[model samples]
Target: MTDISVFPNSLQKLVKAFEEPLPNLEAPPGMPRIKLNEVIGKVAYFYEKLRNSIEFQEEHLLRRNAIERILRRKILLENRNLVDARLLINELIRARYLPNDALPDAIVGVVQNYIDRYIALLDHLKLRRTSPDDRRLIRWLISVASADIEERLSPSVREDALVEVMYATIRNNLVLPESIPTGQEQDILVYLAIHRALIKSDDAILRYHLFRWAYPQWQTPDHAVTEQIKSHFQQLVEAIERRINHPLSERLLVICRQYTIPFLVLADVFKERPGEIRELLTSPEALNDASEKAMTKRIKSAGSRLRRTTVRSIIYIFITKMLLALAIELPYEVYVLRLSNFLPLYINAAFHPVLMAFIGMSAIVPGKKNTQLVVQAVQEIVNPSAPRMVFGKKLKPRPRSRFRVWLFNLAYLLTFVVTFGAIIRLLQYLEFNFVSILIFLFFLSVISFFGMRVRQVVKELTILTRRENLLLLLLTFVSLPILRVGQWFSKKIPKINLFIFILDFVIEAPFKIFVEVVEEWFSFLKEKREEIS
Candidate 1:
C-alpha cells in the first residue's frame, strides 16, 4: 500500500516537472537531488520560459517582418521592371482593340493634375489619415471612368488604403499587429494594375481613359491641407488607455522570399495566369498540392541524375583501384620484399585497396527513394519527433551501476586507442615499406572516413530507437578510430591526399564540366520545347 501511494505522488511530480523544459530528476543511489545537473536544469527551465515569453515572440515577429519587408521591396522592384517590359508588349495588343479611342492630350493633362493633387494631399497627411472628404474624393475619382463600376470597385482598393496607412503608421514609429496583413495579393495586384495602366496607357488608353472620365470637374482648392495640418497637431493628446500592440514588397519580394522550386515554377505559371495564382493562394489545399507535385518532380530529376553519376563513378573507381593496386604493389615487391614470386604480394596489396574501392563505390550507390528521404529529413531539420516519452514524462533509462559504467567508459577509450595502434603494427608486421605504409594508410583512411560518413547519413534518417542506438554503438568501434586516422591524415597533408587528388583532378573536374555542359544544353532544349508547346 505504501509503494502504491508513493508511485502516484512520484508520477504526479514527474508529470508536473515535464511542464517545464527541464528533464525530470531521478535520484541516483546515495546521491542528493540538488547537484550541479539539477542547478543547470533549473537554469534551463527559466531559459525556456524566457524564450516563450511575450516579449520574445514580439521580437521574433518584428525580426521576421523586417527580413520579409526587405525581401518584399526587392521582389517589388524586379516585378515592377517585368511589368513595365510586359506593359510595352501589351500596348501593341491593346492598340489593336482600341485604335481610335486613344487618350486625348487634354485628358492626359487633367489626369496628371488629379494624380498630382491626390499625391499632394497624400504627401501632406504623410500617409496617416485621409479625411472622410478625402476618402470620398478618392472613391469618386476611382468611380469616374468605368461604365460598369460598382459602388465598390473591389475590397482591394480599400485594403490598399489600409496598407498605405499601415505603411505610414510604421513610418511614424508605431509597431502594430494590423500591419502584418498589409501585402494581400489582391491589393498588390489592384495597385499594380491601376498604377501601370496610368503609366503605360500611351499607345492603348481605354483603362486610363475611363479613369480620366471618372474625375469630377470641380476644382477644389488646396485649403484642406493647411487646415488638416494644423488640426493634426492640435488633436495630438496623451490618452493613457494602457493598450499593448505588436508589430511587423514585390517581384524581388517573391523571388527573395520563396526558395523552393515548386514556388518558382508555380510563380512562372501564375505569371501567365494571374487569376489562377489568386485562386490557388485562396485555396490552401490546392496550392499545397501543386507545391508538393513540383517538389516531387524536382527530387525525382535529382535522383535520376545522381544515379547516372554513381554508375559512372563505380566504373571509374573499379578501374582506378585495379591500376593503382598494380602500380603500388610492383614497386613494393621489387624494392622492399625482393621477391621473385610477386603473386602473393600482389594479392596482399590488393586486399585493402579493393576493400577501399568498394567502399567508395558503395558511397555513391543510390539507396531506394534516397533523394526523397534526404529531402524529407532536411525539411524536418533532421528531428522529426520529440524524444520518446512515457505518457507526458520522459522515460529515463535505469542508471547503470557505477562499476559497470566505469568499465564501459574504460573499454570505449581502450578500444579507440588500441585499434589505431594495431593498424600501425599490422602494416609494420607485413614488412611494408614507406610507400606501402602510405598506401595502406590512405586506403584505411578511405574506409574509416567513408564508413563514418555512411553511418552519419543513416543515423540522421533513423530515429533514436533502442535497436538503432545498439547498432550505432557497435559501429563506433570500427568507425571512430578510422575517423580519427582520416582526420589525422587530412591534417598532415591538408592540401593533397592520393585518393582525393586522383578523384578530383583526374575524374571530378572533367566529369563535372561535361555534365554541366550537357545539362545546360538539355535545359536549353527543354525551354525551347516549353516555348513551342
Candidate 2:
C-alpha cells in the first residue's frame, strides 16, 4: 500500500471527510405522514416537467427552485400561515420534488422554527414595512433561509466534501494578480468560481451561499447576533452584489472550468471504492486505473447528456414559439394587420426548434485523447509531488480613449445590422409580415444563444484547451450580436415571462386545491371502509 503520510494536505482532508461518520438525524416517533394519491401524483409530476422545460434552468437548480416556488405560492399567493410547514412539505412530496416519506414530519416544525427566527430578526430590525427595499430584503432573507432549511433536511455530505476538496485544490493552484489583493476578497473569488463551475449554481443559490458565509450564525442567531446582522445588512448586500459580478469572475471561472472535469473524475473514482478511498488515493497505479475508467464512463455519458439537453432545448423553444405565435402573431394578423395568412405563423413555430435540434446533434463529443488528458489531470491533482497548476491573469480596465470607445461601439452596431438585417431581408423574401418577422427574430436570437449554452456540455467533457481558428473567429463575428441579444433576452424575458405568470398565479393555485380535495375525498372513503370493517 502507498504511504498516506506522503499525500497532499488537501487530499488528506478529503480522505478524512470520506471516512467520517454521517451525523445522525433520526426522526422522533409518532410523527404523522403525508401521502398523495398515485393518480394525482402522476399528473402533478407531468405538469412539473412541462412547466420546468419553459423556465430553462440548470438541472442542479431545479429542486431549490421548486422549493422556492412552493414556498412563494404558499406564503404569497394562497396567504397560507407561515407555520403550516407540514402542508408545504406535503405538497412538495406530492409533486415529487422531495421523495415520498424521505423527510421526517418533524422537519415541518424545524422549518417553522427557522422561519420564526427570520421573522423575529425582521421584527427586531423595525424596517419600515412600506419601503420597497425593506420588503424585498425581507422576501430575500426568507427565501435564503428556506433554501438553507431544504439543504439541512437533505444534506449532500459527500458532495459537500467533494466540493470542499475541489475548492482547496483550486485555491492552491490559482495565481491571482497583485490587483486582486490577498484577503477574504480573493478567497471569495475562488469559492464563487468553484460554486459556478462545478455545481452550476445560479444567482439565488450563490446569494444563499454568500449569505451563509457572511452570517454563519444566521441558522441560530442570538439577540446580539441578530442586532449585528441588522446593523451590517446594507453593507452585506452591497458586498455580495459587488462580489457576485467581481471583475475577475470570468477569468477565474475559465481556470475552474478547466479543472472541473478532472475533479469530477476523481470523485467518480472514489465513489466506486468508498471503503478504499484512502488506499486508492495513496496508490498511484490504482488511482490511475480508476481515473481512466471514470473518464471513459464520463465520455460515454456526455453524448447522452448532450442529446437530452438538446431535446429539452428543442422542446422549450418549440413550446415558447407556439405560445408567442398564439399570444402575439396570430392576434396581430387577425386584428392589427387585417390579414389571415397562417403559413408564416406555422413556419415561425417550427423553425427555431428544428434549428436547435440540428445544432445539438452536430456537437462533437470528446474522444480518446481527451480522456487521456483528463486521466493525467486527475493524477496530477491528487499526487503531492506534481507541480501546481498555476493560473494568473492581470485585471485590466476598459479603454478610456473617446475615439477608441466610439470606434468599438460603431463596429458592434455594424455587427448587429449585418447579422439581423440579413435575417430580416430573408424573412421579407419568405412573405413573413412585420410582426411575424419580429417574433421570429426574437426566438432565433434566444434559441441560438441557448443552443450555444447546451454545447457547453461537450466543452465540459473536454480536457484539452480549445484553440480558436479562422472559421471560428468568422462565425463568432457574425453570431456575436445575435448571441448577445439572445443572452440579454434570456435574462430579461424570464422576469416578465407570461407563461410562468399564468402557470404560477392563474392556474396553479386552483389546481393544487383541487388535488388536495381529491386526496381528502380518498382519505375519507378509506376511513369509512375501515369503520365498517
Candidate 3:
C-alpha cells in the first residue's frame, strides 16, 4: 500500500485506467482522448518504477513478475493495438517530459531492459517443466498486473519462435510440422525489427536468425529476411573493397569464409530485390505464393538431378570396372607362362561376368530407401509432441547384465571374422592365384564401399535402429580397403567414358523410364489431392 503511493500521480492514474473496463474505441462522451503529454509522463514514471522493481528488489521472481506487467502496458500503448499510436509523443519535448531527441531512444532503452530481464528469468527456467497450475497462475499475474501482453507480444514473438522451432526440426532432418505459421503477414514487422536489431548488434541469438534464414532448404526466407541477408552480404563486400592492402583483403577473405558467405556466391544477391520485396509489407499472400512455388521447384529439381547423377555414376562405374579387369588380366598374360595350373581358377575369379553382374544389380535394390513412414518415425524421435509422464513412481533401470552384452559382442566378432576368412579360403581352395584373389577382393571392396555411401545418404533421411547401426559398422571395416583402392584408381584413370556407349542401351534407358514414371506418379497424386481439397 505504501509502495502504491510513491508512484507519480500520472502513473497511478494510468494504472487505474487500465484496471477499469476498456472504454469504447472512440472516446466516451467528453472523456477526451488521452493527451500526448500525459501519456509520455506516465511512460517516464512507469519506466522508473519498472527499473526500481528489477534492480532493488530482493525477490527476483516477484520483481520479474512486476516488470512483466508494466512492460505489457507500455508495449500496448507503443503499438496501439497493432495500429498506429493516436497519442503522439512528438509533443513530449514541449511539455518537458523528456528532451527533444531523447524520447524514442529512452522508450527503446526502458522496453529493451524489461525484455532482457524477462528473457533472463525465462532462461533460468530452461528445460524444466512448469506445472500447468503454476503456468496458469503466472500468466494470470502477468495479465492482471499489466494489460494483455499475451495477445500483443504473442504475435510479434510467435514468428521468431516458429522460425526457431522450424530450424531445430529441419537441422535434425525432421519433417515440417503443420502447426508452424505458413507465411503470415503479422510476422513481417517483427521480422524486420528483429533483423534491424541483428545488424546493429552482435547478439548471437539475433545473428542466428540471419544465419538460419540464409539456408533456403528448411524454411524459405521471406522478402524481408532475404533483404537483410543481402544487406549483410553487401556490407561485407563494401568492407572488402575499402581495404586496399593485401593483408586487409586476406583478413576479409577469412572472415567471409568463416561466415560461409563468399563474394562469388553473393555476386547475384545484390542484383535486385525481388518484386515480392518491392510490394507493400502488408501483402503477404503474394509473398507466400512465391515462396511455395520456389519450394516446389527446388524439391522437383532435386529428384530429377538426383536421377541424372545416378545414371551418370552407374555408367562410370561399369566402364571403370571393365578397364580395371583388363588392366589386371593383360599384364598377367604377358608376364607369366600359360602352363600354370591356376590359370582356369584365376580366369573364373578375375573375369567372371556373373560376379560383375551381381555388383551392378546391387544398385537396383539400393538398401535403406526412404518412405513416408520412415521419415515420420525419425521426426517423432527428434520432436515428439505429446507430454510424457515424469512424476510416476520410480521404475527400476533396465538390466544391463554384462555377461549377455559380452556374449553378444563375442558372437558379433566371430561372425564378422569368419565370414571374411571364409571368402579368402574359398578363393585359395579354387586355386585362384594370389594376384587373382587380390583383384577379386578389390572388386568386392568397391561394391561394399558403394553400398556404405548409399546407406549413409539414407541414414540422413531416417534414423537407424541398433541392428541397422551394427550392420553398417560391420560393412565399414570391409569398405575401408575398397575406398582406398577407389582413391588410387581415380588417380590412375582420371577420366573414362566407354560405359556411355554400352550402358545407354541397357541401364540408362530403363533408369530414365523409371524416373519419368515416378515424376508422373507424383504429379498425379498432387493433382488428386488438390482436387479432393
Candidate 4:
C-alpha cells in the first residue's frame, strides 16, 4: 500500500523534473511516473506554446504600425547608395518571417540608419512618444497609395497585380525543409524559408532543422561561436522585455525584438567586419577552457576502455571474420583452387601498387614517437626546416615493423595448414573422402580475402599518409568481396546457415556505412576549403 501511494506522487514530481533536458540529467535507479508521461507532454507543450506565441505576435505587429511613417520617410528620402529602400522593406519582411525568439543571420545586412533609428528610439522614450503624429501622416500616405488615379486604372487592379507579382516571387524562391542545399548561396535562400517559420514563432520547424543537421554533436566548431551567439541571444531576449512593455502585446514585442536583434547585431558587425557572419551562424563549437578539455579527454579514454572490453576490438574482428568464412564450409583445396583462379588476376591489377604502398607505410610507421614524426614532419607549421615531428620538435625513428609483419604472415599461413590438417582428420573420422580438401579450400579462400581486407583497413587506420586516398581504396576493398562472393555461400549453404548469413551481412554493412561517412567527410572538407579560399 505504501509503495503504491509513493509511486503516484513520485511520478508527478518526475514529470516536472523531466521538463528540463533529459540528456543533461543523471539517472540512479527506478522508473518514475512523471517520466512515463513526459515524452508526450513535452512535445504537446512545445507545440502549444509555439502556437500561442505566434497568434499573440501577429496581434502585436498590427498594433505597432506607429513607426511606419518614419520607416517610409527614411526609405523615400535616403540616397539609394547610402541607405537602400529595399533594405528597409526586406528587413521588416524578414522580421515578420523569423521567430520572435530567434533572428535569421540575414539581418546582418541592415543599413546603419535603420539600426541607429531603432537604437535611438530604444534609448529615448520621449522620441517614441512624439512619434504619434507621424501615424496620422502614415495613414494619409497609405490612403493616397490606395486611391484610384483620376486619369489612370483602378486602385484595386494595381494592388492585385502587385500582390500577384509578390506571390509568384515567393513561390519561385521558397525552399521546403527536405531540399538539400547545393552551395553556400543556398544557405542564404534556405535561411529565408527558415526565417518565415520563425516569423510565425514555429519552434517545431527550428527543432526539425536542428535534428536534420544532427544538432550540436555533428556540427564542427569554427570559432566556437555558436555558444557566443546563444549566450548573446539569451541576453538579447532579457533586454527586450525590460525595455519594451505596457503599450503593445508584450509577448509579440518580445518575440519581434529578440528576433530582429541578432540579425541586426550581426549585420552591424559584418558592415565593418564583412565575412564574420558565417563564423557565428554555421560554426558548431562551444568553446571550452583547458580544464574542460582535459576532462573530456579523460572521459573519451574511459569510454574507449569500456568499448574495447565490452564492445569488442581487433581480436574480435579477426575471430568474427574467420568464423564467418568457416561457416561457408568447403574443402581447403577446392576453395584455394577457386580463389587462385581469381585472386592473382585481381591482385595484379593497378590496385596492387596502392596496396603495397599501404603495406610499406605500415612498415615505416611503428612506434608512437615515429608515428607523430611523420604527421608533424609533413607540415612545417608543426615542424621547422630540417623537419621535426610532434610539436615542431626533434623526431625519432619508429623501429621497423617488417619483422612483426613476417611473423604475422608465418602464423597466419601455419594456421591455414593446421586448420586443413584438422579437417583432414575429421574427414577420416567420418569416412567422408575428399571432404577435408573441399571444406578447407572453400574457407581458406574466404578467410584469406577477409583477412587481407581487414589488414588493409588496419593499415589505413594506423598509418595516415593520405587519408582521402586511403578512403577511396577502402571502397574497392569493401565492394570486391561482396561482388565476388555475396551471391554464393550464404544463399547456397543449408544447415547452420546463421553464421554465414550474419558474416555476409556484417561485411556489407560496414562498407555502406563507410560510404556515408566519407560523403559527410568530403562535405566538411569542401566547406573548409570555401572558408580558406
Q: How many backbone clashes does candidate 2 have?
A: 0
Q: Put down candidate 4 lDDT per residue, 1-533, tens digits, no spaces.
A: 11222222322232223223322112234522111122323433353343333221233233122123224334232211133433333223322321222323333332343334323322332222235554433333322221211001111222222222222222223332333335543343334332432233222222323322333431233233334433343343333332222122222222222222112222223233333323322222311122123333333443443333322223443444355334432233245444323232222222323432333233321234433332332232111243422223221212337798799778656654665566467645644334334533454444334334333322321322344688777555443443344234433543245543343244323432343355457658778999999
**lDDT: worst 10-residue window of model 3:** 261-270
Best by TM-score: 2
Determine the C-alpha RMSD for candidate 2 after optimal superposition of all C-alphas: 3.4
Candidate ranking (TM-score, best to worst): 2, 1, 3, 4
Query: Candidate 1's residue-wise lDDT over 202-282, tens digit each?
Result: 111222332322222314545654345335422211110000001102231222111122222333233334445444434
Backbone clash count for every predicted candidate, in the order shown: 12, 0, 0, 24
Cα RMSD of predicted structure 4: 29.7
Q: What is the TM-score of each candidate against the true structure?
A: 0.31, 0.88, 0.29, 0.19
Model 1 superposed RMSD (Cα): 27.2
Query: Where is model 1 poorest over a 10-residue stretch in terms of lDDT?
Result: 239-248
Q: Ten-residue segment with the worst summed lDDT in candidate 2? A: 390-399
RMSD of each: 27.2, 3.4, 28.2, 29.7
Candidate 4, position 362, lDDT: 36
Residue lDDT tens for model 3, 90-174: 2222223324432333343433333443333333333122455545333332332222222121122323332332223222221
Tell how far residue 149 is off in model 3, in angstroms. 46
Query: What is the model-wide C-alpha lDDT for candidate 1?
Result: 0.37
